[model samples]
Target: MTHSVKPRARAADKRRRLTIEAARVLHEQGVERTTLADIARAADVPVGNVYYYFKTKDELVLAALSEHSAHLDELTGRLDQLPDPRDRLEGLIRAWVDQRDVAARYGCPTGTLAVELDKRADGTLDTEAGTVIRRLLDWTGHQFRALGLPDPEDLAVTLISAYQGMSLLANALRDPDLMARQGDRLLHWLDSLQSPDPTA
Candidate 1:
């Protein structure tokens, strides 16, 4: 029983590693260009082993999508530790700013994946990709609601759209500084949304 458990655990670990590498490769190379061999090489697993874990490229893509979703959850969960909704939102922007270099080179991980998968005629992959962006919109709206905003949902769309637009430009022009500058503007805009102190 102990020996069997060890092999199962190892298999799970290898599967996870493959998914992680797949996400990285897909982000860097785009979905259509990345092959199973690329993912296997990145993960340091045999190409044959990749088949054992994921029968097709689509299956691997699904695993990578799941990885992106989990990463979003982790990021939001970390920011939720902040006491203030404003602070949480600011933290999120800052996090993106920190990744400006990567964004400039490969584009926003979640955003790029969504845009690419959206072109698929099958619709299934695109639907799954849409959920990641939807989750971000919903989470951002929740933060706006916490701040007592009258138009939380609209504000959420505006904020996310701004970020996505900036990300697109940054990647197109290969400018990391653009993301930093836009992040600062976004932080300032968020600050402006707060109600002024009545006592003052």
Candidate 2:
């Protein structure tokens, strides 16, 4: 006899699928254009089921942002495997550079969504949507601090801004090579910041 699946397990599975589908749809279509029905269709769940997991579109947006946050955390953790903070930062830049094609086609997921959410005053996302960039800033700032920069936070902001700017231009121009070139410039800048350690 086949055993029946538990309610909680099924619910968790549905929630996970919803989150994944929401992220995909939100990335492909801006928040204003993506409806719950689109997400439900993508996730293969009943449209009514979306309400059980997310009461409103805003809730699903926040859930998608949370998913992006988790992805950033995982990337940070992977970068941490590098011994040097500078190397970690390079790894971060390289990671973005590697996604140049995707960025060109769809824009940076976090950057695009953050800007979209900020333009709204309907309480759809507010400052909470910006947490994705803030997390990157904080993490990059920490790496800069480890590199002994006096103004690590500012440096972090600059780096993040540069990456965002590159993404914006690349997406607007639909030029993946532009992003890769910018990535090289960022790596060169990072290299310039390096000097012979006084202690060594």
Local accuracy of candidate 1 as per-residue lDDT tens digits, 1-200: 99999999999988999999999999999988999999999998989999999999999989999999999999999999999999999999999899899999988888898888888787678888888899999999999999988789999999999889888899999999999999999999999996545586
In the range 80-104, model 2's lDDT, one tens digit per residue, is 9999999999999999999999899
Steric clash pairs (candidate 2): none
Measured against the true structure, the TM-scores of the candidates, in listed sequence, are 0.96, 0.93
Worst 10 residues of 2 by lDDT: 1-10
Q: What is the lDDT of residue 106 in candidate 1?
A: 89
Model 2 CA deviation exceeding 4 Å by range: 1-5, 195-200
* Stretches of model 1 off by over 4 angstroms after superposition: 196-200
